[model samples]
Target: MTALVLSLAAVGVILAFLGWIFPAGSVREIVVGSVMVACLFANAILLLAGDGVVGWREAWWNVLLLVSAVLAVAGGGPLTTSVLALVDRGNTRAQSTQKAGEVLRGGALIGCLERAAIFASVVAGWPEGLAIVLAIKGLARYPELRSPDQPASVTPQAVAERFIIGTFTSVLWSVACAGLLLSR
Candidate 1:
C-alpha cells in the first residue's frame, strides 16, 4: 500500500512537470489534474484503510514524504489553471484572459511558492503557517488587486474573483497532498 501510494505520488510529480514544460492547453491540464486527483484519492484511501505502517526512519517513507511534497507544489499549477479555466468558461474568454494576465502577473510562481509553504507548514504541524502564508500573499498582491491598471474591459471584481479562486484551489490541493504524508 505504501509502495502504491509512493508510486502514484511519483507519477503525479512527473505529470506535473510535463504539464509545466508543455504549453498550457486543455489536454495537458486535464491529464495533470486527473493524475493529481487520483493521487489524492489514493492517499485518502490509504489513510482511511490504515494499512501502511512504515516508520519515518525508513527510506521508502522518506521518499514518499519528499515525493508527496514535490507533488503538492508541482501539481497545484495545473490544478489551479484548470479551475480558473472552468470559471472563465462563462465569460468572454479573450477579455477575461487579458484581464487575468494583467491583474495577476507572476501568479504561477506565486502559487507554486504558496503551495510549497502551505504543504511544509501543514506537514511540520504548524497550521498557523497557513495564515502567515496567505497574509503575506494578500499583502503583496494588495496593490495590483486593489486597483489594476487594466483596460475598461477588465473589472476589479474579476481580478478579485480570480485571486480568490486561484488561492483556494492551490491551498486545497497542497493541503490534500500534505495529508498523504500525515497518514503515516
Candidate 2:
C-alpha cells in the first residue's frame, strides 16, 4: 500500500511531463492520463477494500473515483501553456520547448497540491478529489522558451528561474512526504 502511494505520485509526475512535452494531437495525453487515473483508482480501491478506512467502504464513492480518474487524465499542462497553446496554434519546436518548461513548473505545483488534495480526500473517502486537483491545467501552456540572452534576451539565470520554482516544489513535496512517513 505504501509502495502504491509512491507510484501513484510517480504516475502524476509522468503525466505532467508528457502533457507539457507532447503536442495536443499526440497520443501522449490519453496514454499518460489513462495510466495515471488507473494507478490512482487502484490505490483508492485497495485502500478501501477492508476495515481500514471507514467511509471508504461505500461502493458508490468507488464508482465516482473511477469516473473522476477519467477526467483527470484528460486535462494537460499549466496555466501558461494552456493559454499560449490556445494562442500559439501548432506543433512547432518553439512551442514544445516553452510548454516543456511550463510542464515542469506545473508538475512541481501539483507535487504539493495533489498530495494535499489526496490526503484530504482520503479522509473524506472521496478519492476523486485528487484527480480534480490534478486536472487544474489543460494542454501545454508555454511554447517559446527563449534562452534569456540569445542576441535579444537577458541573463541565463532568468531562464533558469522558471525551472528553479519547479525544483523547489519538488523538494517541498519530498519534505512533506518524509514528514508523513516519519510521523507514522
Candidate 3:
C-alpha cells in the first residue's frame, strides 16, 4: 500500500509537469490536471484510510517524503492554473488572453519554491514556517504589485486577484500533500 501511494504520487507529479509545460487553458492541460487531481485524491484516501501497516525502514520513509515533496511542488502550477481558469471564466476574451506572467512575473518559479518550502515546513513539524514564507513572498512582490508601470493590458485588480488566488492554491496544495504523509 505504501508503494502504491508513492507510485500514485509520482505519476501525479509527472502529469503535473506535463500540464505545466503545456499551454495554459489548453485541452491537454485540463486533461492532465484532472488526472493529477484524481491521483492526489486517491493517494489521500489511501493514506487516510490506513490501508495497511507502513512499517518500512528509514530509507523507504525518506523516499516517501521525497516523492510527496516533489508532488507538492510540481503539482502546484497546474492546479493553480486550473483554479484561475475557473475563477476567470466569466471574463472577456481580452482580459482572459492576458498571460499570467505579464502581471505576476516569475510567478512560476516563486510558486515552485513556495510549495517546496511549505511542504517541507509542514512535514518537518514547523507549521509556523508557513507564515514566514508568506510574509517573505508578500514583501518581495509588494513593489511589483503596487507599481503603476505595469502593462496597460494588466490591471491592478487582475494582478491582485492572480496573486491571491495563486498563493492560496499553491499553499493549500502543499499542505494537503504534506497532510497525506503525516496521516499515515
Candidate 4:
C-alpha cells in the first residue's frame, strides 16, 4: 500500500512538471492545479495512515522523499518563473524579453541543482549550509547582474526584483519540502 501511494506521488510530480512546461491555456492551469492539490492531499494521507519512515532504508518513504525532491528541483524553475511573471505583469514585453538571456544562461539548470542541494542538505541535517549555497549563487551571478555592458533596456532594478522573487520561491519551495520530509 505504501509503495503504491509513493508510486502515485511520483507520477503526480511528473504530471505537475509536464503541466507547467506545456501549459495550454486554462486546461494546463486546471491540470496543474488539480495535480498540486492531489499531491498535497496524498501526502497528507500518507502522513496520517502510512507506516513511519524514520530511516533512509525505509523503502516506501524513501521513494516518496526522492520523488518530492525531484519535483522540487525539476518543477521549481517553471513554478518560480510563472509566479514572478505574474508578479511583474507590468513589465513590458521588451523588458521581459530582454531579460530572457538571464534565464537561458544556465539559470534553469542551476536552479534545478540549487533546489536539489537545498533539499538534500537540509534532509542530511545541514540546513545551515544553505546560506553558503545562496552566497555562492549570488556571487556567481553578481558579475552579470551589475555588468556595465548590460543592455540599457534592462534596468538593474528589474533584474534584481526578478532574481529575488525567483530565488525566494525556489528556496522556499525546497525548504518547505525538506521540512515536510523531516516531519515524516
The TM-score between candidate 4 and the true structure equals 0.78
lDDT of each: 0.80, 0.41, 0.82, 0.68
- For model 3, residues 26-75, the per-residue Cα lDDT tens digits are 66787888898899889878776774226756686777788778889998
Off by over 4 Å in 3: 51-54, 93-100
CA deviation > 4 Å runs, candidate 1: 52-57, 93-98
Candidate 2 residue lDDT tens string, 73-140: 22323322333334334645443334444434445344445545544554455656645654543223
Weakest ten-residue segment in model 2 by summed lDDT: 175-184
Clashes of 1: 0
The lDDT-based order of candidates, best leading, equals 3, 1, 4, 2
lDDT tens readout by residue for model 4, 4-71: 55675677677657756664234464456456546755765665565545543567667778787877
